[model samples]
Structures are given as structure tokens and as C-alpha cells.
Target: MSGLLALLDDVAAIAKVAAASVDDIAAAAAKAGAKAAGVVIDDAAVTPKYVHGFEADRELPIIWRISLGSLKNKLIILLPGLLALDYFAPWVITPLLMLGGAYLCFEGAEKVVHAFAPHADHEIEEDFDTKDPAHLEEEKVAGAIKTDFILSAEIMTIALDTIDSPNFWMQAITLAVVGIFITVAVYGAVALIVKMDDVGLHIAATGRTSGGRALGRGLVLAMPKLMAFLSIVGTAAMLWVGGSIVLHGLEDTHLWAWPYETIKHIAETTAYAMPVAQGFVKWLVAAAIDGVFGLILGVLLIPVATRVIGPLWATMTGKKAGPDGHPG
Candidate 1:
């Protein structure tokens, strides 16, 4: 009986430690996830477009497929890569992060350019209304998954960089939790956002009370504006987060310091000017400065990416396979 009691006590102690560790992991994941909020919001906002023009019945399934792909991208590919980078070449993390940040900036800037120049709804609608629904669905799903992979990579890396774990296992668990939680949160929000119009329609049609019916009608009317607002917000967030990441990376690698320092000092001065709204002022200043930097970098990168990188990618992917067996 005494030996049995000792074994039970040992198990109880182990359980307590495990429980504590779980709490720590959850706390870290939440913190890290918060840091990557911009990318998360952008991911959620962009994903719904994939479901556009699909039959109402098919939207949820399409979102589910994309969500699953996002999960695999984060947990399977990015998680291992992050761990390996942390352990072997910790120095590479900053550069990679900067690269990801640049991508985000480019994405955000492209959206901005599109908004002003306004690509005619020509191609997107054409693709959606394609004769073969099956082929269109496949293409859209593949495109969404590829896009999710890029955003997921950013989210996971941001989470990994933020975590302050003491060991490999803890880091792994924290990142895994972060990845799963973020994926669920993003997709769950997407699902809710996408189906809200249907829900509104149902409520508007079936509600027993007049007030309820009015609310439902209002919801139906409001959804498109809400989606548009979210898109704008998402783009701004991408620029802010992307530019901030690149600035931090530059500081970390000692490539640049004066500009960031100057920004901080200006923010501090601005904070002093608005003592009551100091925190908000500081954040606003920082975000604005970051956004400016992001726009500049993105504009510079646009031409290089279009002219140089695009051609190189086409060549490598054999997208230019020619009849004469020559480069197009």
C-alpha cells in the first residue's frame, strides 16, 4: 500500500507539471498570435474571395479545404523549418522574416494600386463563370491554398519568433498550439463572415418579430460594405506589420538604426504632446511611419519582381515551354 501511494504521488506530481506547461504554452501562443494579428486578419479577409461565385452549398466545403491546406502548411512544413532554423541557423531567421515582410508589403501595395487603378472585374468574374464549374473550382482552390501557404508561413514565423520557450519540446508545442489556434480562428471567422448574408436572408424571411426582421434586413444590406471595409483594413494592416518587421530585422542585423531610432524618438515626442492619448498617439505614429516605409519598398520591388523575378520564375517552372524548344 505504501509503495502504491508513492507511485500515485509521483504521477500526480507529473500531471501537475504537465498542466502548468500547457498553461504556459497557451499564454505564449496567444501572445505570439496577437503579434501576428495583421497577417491573420489579411488571411481571413483574402480567403473569402476564393468562395466567391461558388454555389452557396459549396462555399463552406471550399473554405474547409483551404483551411486544411493552411493547417498543413503551418504545422507540417513551416513548423519543422522554424525549428531547424532556430537550432542550426538562428541567424537566418531575421533575413527570412524580412523577406516575408517584403512579400506582405508587396501584397498590400499591389492591392492599393489595384484599388486606385481598378482592374476591371474582367478576369475574376470570367474565371468564376467559366463553362466547366469543376475546373474553375479546382483552380480557385489551388490558388487559395497557394496564397494561404504564404500567409501561413508569415503567421508561423511571427509566432515562432515571439515565443520565449526554454527547450525544443516546449517551443514545438507552443508553435503547434499557435498554428492550430490561429488556423481555427482565421477560418472560423471566414466561415462566419461568408455565411452571414445567408443567415441574414433566412432571418429576414422567417423572423416572427418585426424588429428581428428589420435587423436581418439591415444585416443583409450591411454585409457587402463590411466586406469592403475589412479588405481595406486588411491591406493597411499588412503594410504596417510588414514594414515593422523589416525595420526590426534591419535593426537586428545592424544594417539600419538611425531611421528606426528617429521614428521612435518622434513617436516619443508625439506621445508627450498628447499626454492623455499618449499610447494611441505613439502607436499611430509608428504605424504611419512603417506604412510609409512599406509603400516605398514595395514600389521599388514591384518593377524588379515583375521584370526580373517573374521571368525567372516562369523559366524555372517551365511555364515557357515552347514549340521551338527555345525561351519565349
Candidate 2:
């Protein structure tokens, strides 16, 4: 009896420890995931375009395929690569982060330029017109997965940076949780966003009440505006998060301190001026400054990327460059 009770106590203690570890992993994953919110939003916003012309039934499947690809990217490729880097070359993380941030800035700035100037994507249009539906679907899915890989790399790296644990297993488990959760969240949202109109139509066609039908019609009417709004918000978030990352990287590397310091000083000054909502005011001021800086940096990078690097990359990779000078 005594031996059995001791074993039972040991088992209970191990279970308690396991439960605590699970809680820690959850908490860490949430924190790390939160750090990648801008990327997450951008992922969700960008994914629906891949399913735009597909049949309603195909939308969810395409999203599921992309989600699986995204999961593989995060888990099979990026997670291992990042862990290796963290173990062997931890110092490289900041520079890579800054590079990713710059990419985000470039992407956001390109969108802003497109929004203002409204250039036609003749190549994309021609491809869509010439390609058969099956081929196009494959191409779109492949392209989306490729794009997701880049964004996923950024997300995972950001998460790794946010994780404070020195234990390898803790870091690994946290990253795994972050990767799986984010993949599901992003692609799940994408599926819903794309299918919302169909749902609206179905409701409009079959609703039992006038109010329900009206709600369905409202949803159908609202989807385009909602997409536009998400795009704008995603672009803004990208710039904000990217600029903040770059600024922090610079500060960390002791390369330049003025940009971050200046933003902090201004934010603090504003916060002092308005004590009622000091934290909110401070954060708003800082984010605004970072976004402006991101915009400027991105604009400057546009010419360099398009004219010089884009051509060189195209030549090296034998891939066609898009209007934004990225390989299509």
C-alpha cells in the first residue's frame, strides 16, 4: 500500500509539472504570436486573392492546400533552420530581422505607390487570360505558397526573437505552437473571407425572414469594402511593424540610435503633455513616426530594388520580375 501511494504521488507530481509546462508553452506562444500580428494580418489579407476567380467549392480546398504548405514551411523548413541558427549563429538574427523588416517596408511602400498611381499588371492579366483554369489554380497556389514562405520566415524569426527561454525544448515547443496556431489562424481567416460572399448569397436566397435576407445582402455588398479596408490596414501595419523592427535592430547593433531615440523622445514628450491617455498617446506617436520613416526608407529602396537588384536577381534566377521588381 505504501509503495503504491508513493508511486501515485510521483505520477501526480509529474502530471502537475507537465500541466505547468503546457501553460508556459501557451503563454510563450501567445506572446510570440502577438509579436507577428502585422505579418499575420498581411498573410490573411493577401491569401484571398489567390482564390478570387475560383469556384466557391474550390476556395476552401485551395486555402487548405496553402495552409498545409504554410505549416510545412514553418515546421519542416523554417523551424529547424531557425533553431539551428539560434543555436549556432544567434547573432545573425538581428540582421536577418532587419532585412525582413526592410522587405516589409518595401512591400508596404509599393502598395502605397500602386494605390496612388494605379499601374496595370499587364503580365499578370495576360497570364491569367492565357492559362487554363487548372494551370492557373496550380500557379496561384504555388505563388501563394512561395509568398507565404517569405512571410512565414519573418513570422517565425520574430517569434524566435520574442521567446525569452534558454531551454532548447521550451523554445522548440513554443515555436511549434506558434507556427501551428498562426498557420491555422491565417488560413482559416482567409477561407472565411473568401467564402463570405457565397455565404451571403446563400443566406439571401434561403433566409426565412426579411431581416436575415437584408443581412445577407448587406454582407454581399460589404465584402469588397471590407477587403479594401483590410488591405489598407495591413499595409499600414506592415510599415509600422517593419519600421519598428528596423529601428530596434539599429539600436541593438549600435549602428544608429537617433531614429528610435527621436521617436521615443517625441512620444514621451507627447505623453507628458497628455497625462490622461499617456500610454496610448505615446504608442500612437511612436508608431506614426516609425511608419513615416518606413515609408521614406521604402520609397528610397524602390528604385534600387527595381532598377538594380531586381534585374540582377532575375538574371541570376532566370525568373520573370513582376511590376514591383520581385520575381513573379
Best by TM-score: 2
Each prediction's Cα RMSD?
3.6, 1.3
After superposing candidate 2 on the true structure, give the runs of residues whose Cα lies further than 4 Å from its correct spot.
127-130
Worst 10 residues of 1 by lDDT: 319-328
Cα lDDT tens digits, model 2, 178-205, are 9999999998888888989989999999
Local accuracy of candidate 1 as per-residue lDDT tens digits, 1-328:
9999999999999999999998999899999999999999999889889888889999999999888988999889999999999999998888999999999888888788778886665644543437888888888888888888889889988988998885899999999998999899999999999999999999999999999999899999999999999999899989999999999898888999877888889988999998498999999999999988998887777676767776776689866422212123
What lDDT score belongs to each candidate, Candidate 1 first?
Answer: 0.87, 0.91
TM-score of 2: 0.97
TM-scores for the candidates: 0.93, 0.97
Which stretches in model 1 have alpha-carbon errors above 4 Å?
121-129, 320-328
- For model 2, what is the alpha-carbon lDDT of residue 77? 99
lDDT of 1 at 272: 90
